[model samples]
Target: MTRCDVDSVVQLQISVSAKRLLRRADGPLRLKQIQEMVIAKLGRAVDHQQLLDVLQTSAKNGVPRFFVDGDMVGLTQRQRPGPRGCKAAGESCPLQPESFEAVATQAQMAQISKATKKLLCSLGGCMPLDDIQDALRVNGWDWKHEQVLHALQKSAKNGVPRYVLDGDMVRLAEGPSCCRRAQKHAATELAAFLQETEFSSCPWNSALSLSSFRGHGEFLQHVVQDERHSDGRPRFEVRKLHGADWIFATESAKLRQQVFEAIQALDAEVQGRPKKLLDESEDMAEISRLGKLMQDWVSGASWLTCLNHTTLVDEVPGIMTRVHLFDGDGIEVRLHMFMDPTETYIHNHRSNFFSYCLSGRYWHKIWGVPDGEAGLDGGHYFVVNRAKDPSFEHPVGKPGHLSVIAAHTHQERGSYYIKAVTPHTVQPQMDGNVATPVLTIYIKDKAPGPDTLVRVANKQELASLQQQQREQQTQDCRLEGRHRLERLRAMHDLTVLTSHSALRKKPRAGVPCKPSRSSPDIAG
Candidate 1:
């Protein structure tokens, strides 16, 4: 047979499920390695397309279609030879390569540039724009000034990870006097200026010395060691003795960041410790970006798209994760998973749910129209969601009441579910020895009043079942408490006697066992 172009059939590992088939081939072959697998199954000179053609065919017929899919290929009982014959057959197999498992190819997994890649798991709202820029520089990466500004703009809380000294490295300060001379000279000159001129004209009546300076506030205090006037006369530069100036700055929410720092400091004080900073090594910009995305996901509202049906309670039997609750109070998305979805009912719009299985090993099913279930028209469904024919505003299922359903349908498990727009009822179950799905009634805008009003003909049996549950619980608690008390007594008895044995046994050291002189005497 003529082979297809070599470029079209890339040399890739066969799918994991396909490799087992190659192993059972009657001819000797290296089935593990891709290159060796093809050569071992066919002659070394066999064209690559020819090998792929066989693989493709097997892939199609594999009962469990692509391992990810539910359809999988299973060898029939007839396909399996006797144990003795199989071992003998293995000796004559052409499979040789051991590393034949298929995986996502490099081309498929190739990542885009770092610039385009979205970051994950980051703190929102940290630091002023300028500080974030410095942090990136420390890591030897240059960030555009505008990009950093944009990051700072997005966060509601602009806070960055604190920088701490490394445990392995010694942290010696830029050691005193780096800018102390500047501070000292500035104070001296200011004092002279005050004496020569009016103290009111001076910014301060009292001068601040280098000794008065603190970190950050002091570090940026003196940018220039010495500043000169136009006449070349040495003019003392009075540093602010505080962090950078924020007056009239263009950094968005600069003041907010400062307030946040103040709050953090106060919190640290209440905790009876200084705030500790971790590695100053984080991309504040990317952290800010992810923070924004998370914020948007939370803050933005979701518009519900209505799918077909009202009062359709579908349950997949046996799936413990069947009770999948989809809840959104317009802020949080809550999904409660159970073995069966039908075991749930909407009581007061309790929750909505939908899901589908991608793998069949865990069998599931959903009972619904199933091709020909007649619709209960004018049933309970919102007019907003399904607008095509618009469901009536009245709630379905006997008009604000509970319903029982037993679902037994479909061959493979059901997953891949979606419930949107309005809250709906769902439960899940697995295949084999199918379990029933229970649904609690949903009473919107009303407190749960009571259970279904239907009276059971066998009241005694119902009471007995309830009594059995309560008894079992009480018995378990009593047994646990009894065992606990036994352990406590055993542990305390030995220690107590040992600690006070002399007190209990001691009566009188020199006196007889008879009465004492001051006490009543006993006659013989």
Candidate 2:
């Protein structure tokens, strides 16, 4: 089925589930209870967050007729069905709400309870009794300390998703699983081992030599076990980022080594044959070959998971995917994926890198301060020393062979080299629901300058850009254009006021931004 069709079905099922759960209830139920009931009745896996999103949407649309309270949900007056909607006098009604005891017998419910316990344990082994009571107390269980403790103890004894600690401190008597101790040991050892031996590369950099680490076997075993017994939720930080086994270290290194060699060979040929002025087509053809090579290298490798810390710089969009394909002694390969309507703030990198667009097209721009001095003052971009007046700086050479325009085309599925000091930004070509994926191979220089790259656009410029986007969106807005326009105006006024306050605090002198010690890095 289509995604929309599936979503519609899920929405209807959720609504039906809510109605059945509240059919005979006299008051509100905790969201947790509602979630448990919904899952039990549907006999399918569903995310609690997903349920919340759908419920919120339903409320906005005036369906399901439920409202949310603090961790609780209640049926609206119109939604509380009468007893006539329940099953016939003797037979049990599937639509009628069941006590937690009735649902607890199910294997799925037991597993969920165990997961909850594990999550609580991860936060801290010990929690207040009140919080534990809320978790263990299912429907029909009186909110008594003794009853909650008894229920948890019974479950723990069954060895079905058992908990080691189930008392006033809401502790885990047992770990998440039988080998949880080993898993924790491996995870800890690997994290420490990585810090010592691995380079501080972003997720978009290559995976360091995991096999070379002392406890490689232990780490691999832990990951394998974690993956095998995973219950959807993450138990540790690494799992939350890339799960347990997104990529095999040995295989990734081997493939990356091959790609690096090929790139080296290409560079040698280009350098040796400089007399044979290469056309744009020839350069692009070479890039296409490299792209094919990368595809072959990643034929069996898993590179879809997020690989790096995304917050490389502030004010960058959080929707992009930066995956490191290969990191070698003097080079690194990365895959960058940008979602629709992306307009990244202007910034520069600290290291030299060559990028090849693997898919889609984008508009790129790069601006550099003349004489390496520039700053913002009174809502305008200026290039000058702190002692002089501000003026605009002209663009230096760009990566691609293109004339000056509003934005350069970071396209052609071909490679182009960008210098370490060059400042640049990219945005979706049409600025709508499109994705741009690029592959970049960074060449680390032995003596690159201190890389202190910072955002060049002042608050005023950013605000104006945002306002333009809002205005463009409003032009196409059908049902909500009026409301959006009002919001846009309010936002613009606020921005203006904020900018004025900021201007008052600005130093009226030299460049708005001063170059600091450059480090080896890239822009967000």
Candidate 3:
């Protein structure tokens, strides 16, 4: 078959597998589980990233009639997904004013006018033009830049309290005082300049001389280096440091894109090369190439995007990751973020992976089980039970001795190389009341493990493992719901604050400012 035909056949197989899996399950299946089933059906593994791409495409096209509920994928009861390109729901749907395409009709213009007023009012009268456009887009109106600016200009020409176009942003004429606007504009411009201008050297660079690092900040005031001799066991240490300028959210997003593209390109190139010709050292060189690409790409992005995408893993609480994977030979790359006050059960994977810390600190423990006895026993049994089956009363065996492969509290951008069979547990290193975010990138070799928790112990452990896992699933759902509500509440509060500010503004001349057409403000 041609490549396109092969892809079509694979797609068909995937669709069939998804249908079969959903039919057998009573509820939505975890994405990890679904991927496992699909892989088994295919008889050949597909990249995790490729699976996500398929799912994302399916979602966009409303194919196979599936819906994503957090990390789970399920067949929606609805015959079709919700209408796309539709504005936010409610009577105040910005689409009420005008259709996305044509010039705003009189009634439509009125609706747009009212919506804009409400938006500005909620924004305390004036906001960036880009922000205004974002609000419109969120409300489902896709107006072009020219269209928005034209409308703003028209409104100014009319006998109303017009919006002032100040550089890239627009502000309500009656909003913040001229002095306040000037101050804000200057600060905004300065911030933009700072963000855009590339620096010659980053303060966080690990290669800086010891004398240069002296008295840089209060945090480094008591800097003490460990003079202890190196042990043979894996000892994590800083491999690289991304300076503050390079660690923003927008910068992270750009880096992720670059890293993803680089991986995809590298995989394609490596696949065509003869396996016999490529030695271990050559493979390492290829990986180093990818790393260098990521470093080069990270120069201009913001750290805020990295934080924004920091998501809690569906199957594991206290563990968060921003993942990007590549096809061919199966490589999964992720930005793993750990939070404090975490209790994580020890588990092992069947892939050699590399981890590099981006920020914060974490307590790392690696355990090595004896060859004959490869599962949890003794005090460690509690950790296993807590992990696999918390409720079941299993006969606890005599405490087994586990060789500690490596254990340490790692801070800074430490690099850790973990073997496939080593079971480890990592938790946030606390500082007083808060647990700072521990950011790291994990590049796992080969396909991911089965959705079922791995245990080499006797069959007794398997008895209620699935049942226990099912019962534990609700926690993930609850967390997802709570996170969504929190974000919604924050947006609502911001809108309310802006609306009240608009209300308080004095009207131009003797005329009272027009009241917003939207419903009463949500309590801040």
Candidate 4:
């Protein structure tokens, strides 16, 4: 044979040996390792440069079968004929059999490009090329790694490239920082609108229009669409109302509707009489019914959504999260989550309300003074006029004592009704262990009023209140609207998990396995 024939034979032998070695290996093999193994398998001396040249030539050809990444090498993953003798099986098969040897069509390239961009976005806009290939395979894309790369290259040829390949890492050419910033800005704008409107749904022209969103309408819509596709509950939803688009806070809207229906049913049963007039037995039965309603709502996935959209989340650091669910006419509903065993200062409410415990335990104390007495014997009185003073500065009063008129250990599913101007305080129960989180629902008989009174027993107690206020202000500054919503969702998820696990334990006969409640007179 001539010298050219001998060279051809050596190249074929080296290619087959390399392929065999790679196919047998568990993962990508180093170039040096491939050469050594191939030579060992051949049982003869072989030139390293010749092997490299053969591998490189094969990879550069139109029907490339090998992938060379720096010093590492591997067999390229190609789509094999399915069991049904087609590239895609079942209903996904094309009308005609597709040839594996043919180049990817324009439509195929476009689909690959779109999927690649989505994968990059989900991966924070950068990923190793191998990882991208593996992810594409996992997602059921039949395209080979070479096909994906070619499609990306073709898509970038005419304009600013959307993606860049550096060494083995594939990244978005423009990076993801700008996109994330725009998304956060859009979320902030929407959150601000919802907060300003008191979580009420608004027309598209009012909040989502280009003019209203300052020319970011398209981008905002994209952000909202992406959020909807995510695993977490979406922040805003667009609904058609009277043939026009309206923006609704997703969780708040659903919760408000549920509460409205519940209240309507209750009103029908009361027959125009004040709800407070229900005798003890009737009131207890109503409370139980409402408790069941709450239990059903909280047990579902929508409760997580409610926690996600709550505007008053994390209002008090380490103490409470008060979510305002609904406020209409003379009735308001609020959900409170208490994390610590701290007791609220003795205080009075400006409206009658019912408290239903959703989980955990607390000590409910009612205080009162004799009809002819000026004040309690050992209490420092402070009139809290939040209407006139947003700072919650307390007006001083003479020190006095207060008698504990009624005290009860409020357990899970327990409920209580307190009349307007009734003095009360709630201290979470601590039975020689860490404090359990307490969740409560409050239904008020009137619109929230600004005037209430708090009585502290000593200077230490007063100082603690001042410290709590300072901490709350600091926390409020640090937590943005989007972050607050995320934090609240996480907290709610953890609480639900713990509560569910506790409920799974063996139950005692004749005792209910329901959750706990919150402060009777606490303002939303």
lDDT leader: 4
What residue runs in model 3 are displaced by over 4 Å at the alpha carbon? 1-257, 269-315, 321-329, 369-399, 448-524
C-alpha lDDT score of every prediction, in listed order:
0.28, 0.45, 0.48, 0.62
Better of 1 and 4 by lDDT: 4
Across 1-524, the per-residue lDDT of candidate 3 in tens digits comes to 01122376677677668767876884577878989988988888876555644553453244334544335566543222235233433212122112222334555555555567677654335556777778899999876654565466456434754665544556565533442343343323323433543321223332122232222221122111211112322111222344342211123344556667767765555446554122233455455555444433433323222323434333243355333334246456654545545735456766666665444567777655555564444333322433354443442443444555567665433455565656777788777888766655566665444222233233344445535555664243323456643432332232334334544775778884432211112222
Q: Supply candidate 3's per-residue lDDT for 219.
A: 17
Summarize candidate 4's per-residue lDDT along 244-274 as a digit string, tens digits: 9877666543554565578656544444455
**Superior candidate under lDDT, 1 versus 2:** 2
Q: Which 10 consecutive residues of model 3 have the lowest summed lDDT?
A: 220-229
Counting clashing residue pairs in each candidate, in order, gives: 84, 19, 17, 14
Where is the poorest 10-residue window by lDDT in model 1? 116-125
Instruction: Name the runs in model 4 displaced over 4 angstroms.
Output: 1-260, 267-283, 305-319, 370-400, 431-433, 447-450, 458-483, 494-524
RMSD of each: 41.5, 26.3, 32.3, 18.6
Sliding window of 10 residues with minimal summed lDDT for model 4: 91-100
| lDDT tens digits, residue span 416-495, model 1 | 22222222233444455664321111101111223222111133433543354344431212112444333223322322
lDDT for 285 in candidate 4 is 65
Cα lDDT of model 2 by residue, 1-524, tens digit:
01122377888798778767766565667778888888899898766666765554464344335544335565543432247454445433332342222223445445544544654544334455566556555533334443343345446455553543321244455555534554554445444443333221123122224422232333344453463313343322223235433322222334445566776655555445534222343454555566545544433222212222231211113334444444444344455545545566555565655566544456666655443232222233422121121121221222222112233566533456556666667676663454543333233322344353433344455355445545443121221335433332332232334335545767668856221111222222
Q: lDDT score of model 1?
A: 0.28
Per TM-score, what order, best first?
4, 3, 2, 1
lDDT, candidate 3, residue 432? 88
What ranking of all candidate models by lDDT puts the best one first?
4, 3, 2, 1
